[model samples]
Target: MSDDNKHDRDTPTWERETLQKLVLATVREQRASRRWGIFFRLLTLMMVFLVVWAYFDFDFPSLAEEKIGPHTALIEIDGEIDVEGTGAADNVIPSLNKAFSDEGAAAIVLRINSPGGSPVQAGIIVDEIKRLRAEYPEKPLYVVVDEICASGGYYIAAAADRIYVNKASIVGSVGVLMDGFGFTGLMNKLGVERRLLTAGEHKGFMDPFSPQSESQKQYAQQMLNEIHQQFIAVVREGRGARLKETPDMFSGLFWTGARAVKMGLADGFGTVDTVARDVVKAEDVVDYTQQEGLPERVLKRFGAAVGEGAVKAMTHAPIPSVR
Candidate 1:
């Protein structure tokens, strides 16, 4: 009787210890799983942060670190001169002021390489260049054309004290043109109805889908003529006796750099480096174009992503530019 009881008790105690060990093992396994899960999550978060940081790291050169010693202040006007862009009034005006005000800057070089864009933008830049030049009469501003300086490009160039160009550069499309497609014939063929509503007469004057009236056409022509005349006056005044004016001088005619010099569209053939050394008499050149930083651009893009719908609603597509 005692042996049987002891055996039964021992069996139950061993089974219970085995059961407790199993429970402890299960708990350890669950804890290990939670720790691994947290590690994976932290690693994933770190990877995502690194990816975002690397994507925005463009490493653009900073100009503030450079000292304003005796040098040619260079502000490049690259790409289309739009109302708001890299080389617009906001960027160019400030650069011009800094260059003009610099006591050590021998001269300012406006290195332009553009096919031209908005007349309004160009006009604004030209006005600012003139003002800065007048304010700092001692500091001469020269335009050194890279590729093609036409339309609005020429408009800005005319304001400079002198204009230089590349040997193969295209210059002087001294004209204003407003271009658009007339979709009436296409709509008639495709049977696509155009339902445009306007409050004022000639509000849809330049609407592609609507038919243009004779008076509307005449009024548009007159406006273009006025702009063209303004261009002519600027060119005539800038070039003065140097310009070889003909019937086609102000007729949107373009010429090569060599021919441009002959036509007085450009002063002569030269590059930024050449003009800086010879004309400006300053070997060292300092860029004054205001550029955006990587962090700032990233934050701006993030903000824009958050508010794109609002910006799109408020903004209107500008009319066909009369360049």
Candidate 2:
């Protein structure tokens, strides 16, 4: 046998050895790459799942069980008084009940900052406040107006034992309004026709594109007057002899906090701190407001911006609001 052949038989050829090592290395690299790829893909899927879970979280806010010493309970009525918003009856009343029911809560201070909204919502809150007060007469409830408490805000505030306000705060708009835009002229200019059909007469009542009928106008005015009277009656019952009534008091006019105090619309100028420290005699103020969770806020805002806008645009009817 040749020396080279004899060496090849004893030990593998160098090329064959190199080739085998190269193939093994390639296989190991490929396996590692596939394992890393799978790991990354799984990581991405887990992150996506977490994001979706957070976004679609179904948990709504409930009153938390808090055990503490004597503190002034604070409930906030911030933003427009509506069914879904922060100042809604559902949100406010529950907090009120919890505050009034709390053994550690010395008193409740309802801090309000709103421009008013649905009269129905405001009325419901007012009724609840009245009921709660009557049920818990010893636990006093006061209102501390923030920026502006007008119309529906004031309606809720009126039920408080006392209302405090900052000197520059806006308060008191004792009136009802059903306001909307008339698009008839704009539609005419654009040469766009509005087609409205209904089974009942005045079914499309106060349609912005259509000319307002005289009878419908009178009916709307009468309804507004009746609601205004109801508002006036509430103010009278709440303020008692404190209110300095004027002819234009219920004429949809607003006033400053200082002016409100002078007109007997508010009790005096104070804040949540002052009311808690000085009036309630408890400096530690505990918030009892039922806050909207992330999901509720996201859904509500999305719906209002898209769906509510579309409905308002199509309907073009005046919404009876106290503003």
Candidate 3:
């Protein structure tokens, strides 16, 4: 063979191998790019989903409607008034602040339906309402009792300028109560020992495992008396001379709406609509309650159920009854 033909044969083989290698390298590079693209797409989708969820959770629309004229804000106080529960001061105070601060809001109506819980929490709310009323003298605050408003619930209602209750509504439990079950007897029966340690003598004064001492009982009673006095002061200040300081008024006794009005514990027997229309001069009442969205409500319900089930399983006891 001639030198040119030999060169051509070698060059063709080399070029064929180079082309094959180039094709393989391109395929590998395409696969790597495709994998990265897929990963980024998935990450972007996840980020979008999270953003949407957060937006819905935190950006819930206001329950109240915007009105041009003087608006009546309906601030609902439902459930137990504890520090951690749905009727917590932390939850209700913000809504109350918003209602009072709204320039369009002519008056605030506290629509209460609670059996009451923490005295401190109720006091905090009552003080805020008083302060807000003093600051915004133009706007009046009213309480519309629904179903029941007793104990700490009445404490909050008494802070309002006036109170309205339904005819059969239960009202006026103006006393403080601290309740805890003593497990000493039960433990004795079960032969379970309670080992409690504290640095201070009075640290465990209210311990359920130990029998209440005379000194401890006296101290607790004094504290309760002080709290009761404070509650009476709030009622007197809020209701002014209108409140009849009868023995029955602060005797931890509840009364029906008719009797409550007679006793001066309530101003009148009426519903929210009646109060809003007649008292506030606005027929339309706007509710500014902070309600959770559907998804959040579902999640909270599911989580609470799971937690309650787990607790029941661990303790082998029924869930504690609501106060």
Candidate 4:
């Protein structure tokens, strides 16, 4: 070895300096490991706390809260009246029952903003409203139309004690319809044939790819007329002497709120706030609309996706609806 290298290797402080550097490196690694362990522990605890909070908070408004004071109970129908939508009978009936049963509710207001939907769903809701109104004769139930309350919406409103609306709102359209696309011509152009086999003669009735039979068409019309008559009876029973019978009233024609009142289809022009304050004589409004929890919302979304696919595959039968 060279003379200078040998002298440095023989120095007394070289071993002491090397040992000190190694000790410092080990200390820093231990500190970093401890910090990460604490961070992970805190994160786990936070997740647990959130799950517990959501579990306890998932519920409708309590009855005790509803009895706090006198207020106008508001139930909103804001979408298509179908089994899968917010305006479904399942959702509205419970809310109506709750509002009617609440002792502190001076009156109940149904705020409707819908074009319309299933006739069956609307009929069920209308029936429930009639029952509630009869059971709670002291408390009145009113309807306040928003932008548009037509067809199925108007059907429900007919059951109310009074129907209020804005002059610009589109009201009425007491009619039912079943619509679908015909693909026979398109299939002929493409030189494609639909070979559908059914056990019953009328099993494939109204199939879009095939010509509709005269007998099936007449049967469908008869069924619709029966439902239409039922609708007319409900409206007459609910409106009593207020309704002015017109030839075109149940011909699926919609009118403005102003014209509706003149025709005796609506009572007067008013909004949710005015009806609650002036008509019900209660300024405070408590929303009794059913609020779905997080789990329900997620499940419904998934279910809707699957249900839509299934419905698309079978488009032969067009269910009657009001719109």
Candidate 5:
């Protein structure tokens, strides 16, 4: 045999060990990958569970579960009252329902501190309040104002049995408005031409980029006047004989609580504690406010912005703030 053939015949075959090592390494990698995947899935599930729990359970849920003793049930409206906000009708009404249904609840108090927001949202809350009050004639609903309760805030307060406030609290703004940008001047300065095309002449209505017509201006004003009249009627119906009406009561102006009392827009001066202790005749006060949780609020604002924009387009255009 040739030398080359002889060397080939003597060579050791190590391919089996090499192939075994390769197979073992591949199996270890797959096992590690599966373990890590399982770990991450468990972590994600735990996080989701915590967020859901927090969203449904109020900050201090123990307060809602206290012993059934005489107590005043409290629901707070602390920020701007918007349909998507914490003080929205959906948020407030559920709290009100829980308060009313509680066996030990002697009375219900709405702690309001807001500069006001959407009139539509306020109207929904007011209607619900009236309905709840009618259903629970034994439980009196009261509003205790903190710093301010204007426009829509006052609208909701009007449905309450009484309104109490501090001397410095801002009370009312009873009106509606439609504010928007008129960019005709900006466009003129910029030499920008707006090329808006629509099938209906008024389809491009209220477009800021286009020139505003006199008729459109008057139409907007008339719509505002109609909403203002509706607001006036609600206040009148709520305050009844208590409201000392004036020419400018619904002129979109705000007033201090003391002046509001003189005008009969508010009932008297008192704090939440005092209202509960004196008027409610219950010393123990329990908060039943359905506060928005961090995770849920974060999810809503971040996730629902796009969805809400679509909803708003289908619904009526954004009404000017009633602030």
Candidate 6:
């Protein structure tokens, strides 16, 4: 009786252990399969994201070609007008050349919407406009101010035979300004030392971290005065006998479209369409602004999207404006 009972008990215990092992192995296999499925899904999503980005970043030219039309060249002057930034000379000058050269173009219109930038850049554009106008005397170049046209912007506008502005347009600043921040006090407070070197005595005259010397200030004032004189000369030349030369005209102050017209800062208050129709007697005006081709736009969009996505993923705060 004891031998039979012992054999039966051993058989049941062995069977139970084998069944338990099989169940455990099945659960482990299911978990592994689920993990691999999740990994594949994530990988597919990433690939799709990459493909979309490439599509936008690389196909701008094709899109532009499709959108371009005859009898109209759209020269866009949007955003800040700086040499290295939006209103770079390289970017706008070439387009201007193209606009002037287009034989089919009836009239070239400068659609300006800027708050002004570097004087050098503005001067270059103004000279080019004058030269081009002289070269093609029959073309009838015109400037149409959109939102704001101040300082360097007005300087550029004065080149045109006629300037058009919206009723509420901020038309003129008629001034020059060179801005910088002095950090000498801040550096001294923080016990930070400046190690700037220069060969000439006045090479670092405008260095923001150092105290400004009286001689340096005087020299800077002289330079600014010279620039102001140059500006006055250009304005007088462009305005001709039309400028009234009042006390406040060139005092670094601005005027609205209505006031500007009364002060002879602008020709008349009108819109692009009005000038094109009434003054030029041409119903169709061409835009000579060069635009980024489809491929460039796509690339830019993709890059921006990727950058924005990365910023979001990392939860970084947006950078503050420098201006």
- Winning model by TM-score: 4
* TM-scores vs. true structure, each candidate: 0.73, 0.77, 0.73, 0.82, 0.80, 0.66
RMSD of 5: 7.3
Superposed by TM-score, candidate 5 places the C-alpha of residue 158 at a distance from the truth, in angstroms, of 0.5
Error of 1 at 15 (Å): 29
What candidate 3 gets wrong by more than 4 Å, as runs, is 1-68, 186-193, 292-323
Error of 4 at 45 (Å): 4.5
Error of 4 at 307 (Å): 6.0
Q: Which residue pairs show backbone clashes in model 3?
A: none
lDDT of 6 by residue, 56-136 (tens): 544344554444443433356676665443365666788778877776655777778888776777778878888988898
Count of clashes in candidate 4: 0
Candidate 4: tens digits of C-alpha lDDT, residues 1-323: 99999977887796769888989989998999999999999999999888877755546666778457999999999988877556988778989998899899999999999998888899999888878878899999999999999988888888899999899999988888888888988999999999998877877888889987889889889988888887788788888899988999989899999998988888998888898788888999999998766765667678867876776565467888888
Clashes of each: 0, 0, 0, 0, 0, 9
lDDT of 3 at 228: 87
Which lDDT values do the candidates have, in the order given?
Answer: 0.80, 0.88, 0.80, 0.86, 0.85, 0.71
lDDT per residue (tens digit) for residues 1-323 in model 5: 99998876776568656878999999999999999999999999999988887767645546537666989999989899876565887788889889988879999999999988888888888888888888889989999999999988898898889999999999999888777777889889999998876776676667778887887778888888887787888899989999998988999899999999999999999999999989999988888887776766776677558777775554323466678
Residues 81-129, candidate 2, lDDT per residue (tens digit)?
9877668887888899999999989999999999999898999998998
Per-residue accuracy of model 1 over 1-323 as CA lDDT, tens digit each: 79988877778777979989999999999999999999999999999988786677545545653455789889988878764446577667878887788787889999888777877778888888877878888889899998888888888899888999888998888888877778899999999999977776755666767887888778878888888888788888878888888899888888899899988888887888898888888988888786655665666567646665564344222233424
Compare candidates 5 and 6 on TM-score and give the better one. Answer: 5
Give the worst 10-residue stretch by lDDT in candidate 6. 314-323
Flag clash pairs in model 5: none
Error of 3 at 144 (Å): 0.6
Model 5 spans > 4 angstroms off: 1-66, 302-304, 311-318
Q: What TM-score does prediction 1 earn?
A: 0.73
> Distance from true position, residue 274, model 4, in Å?
1.0
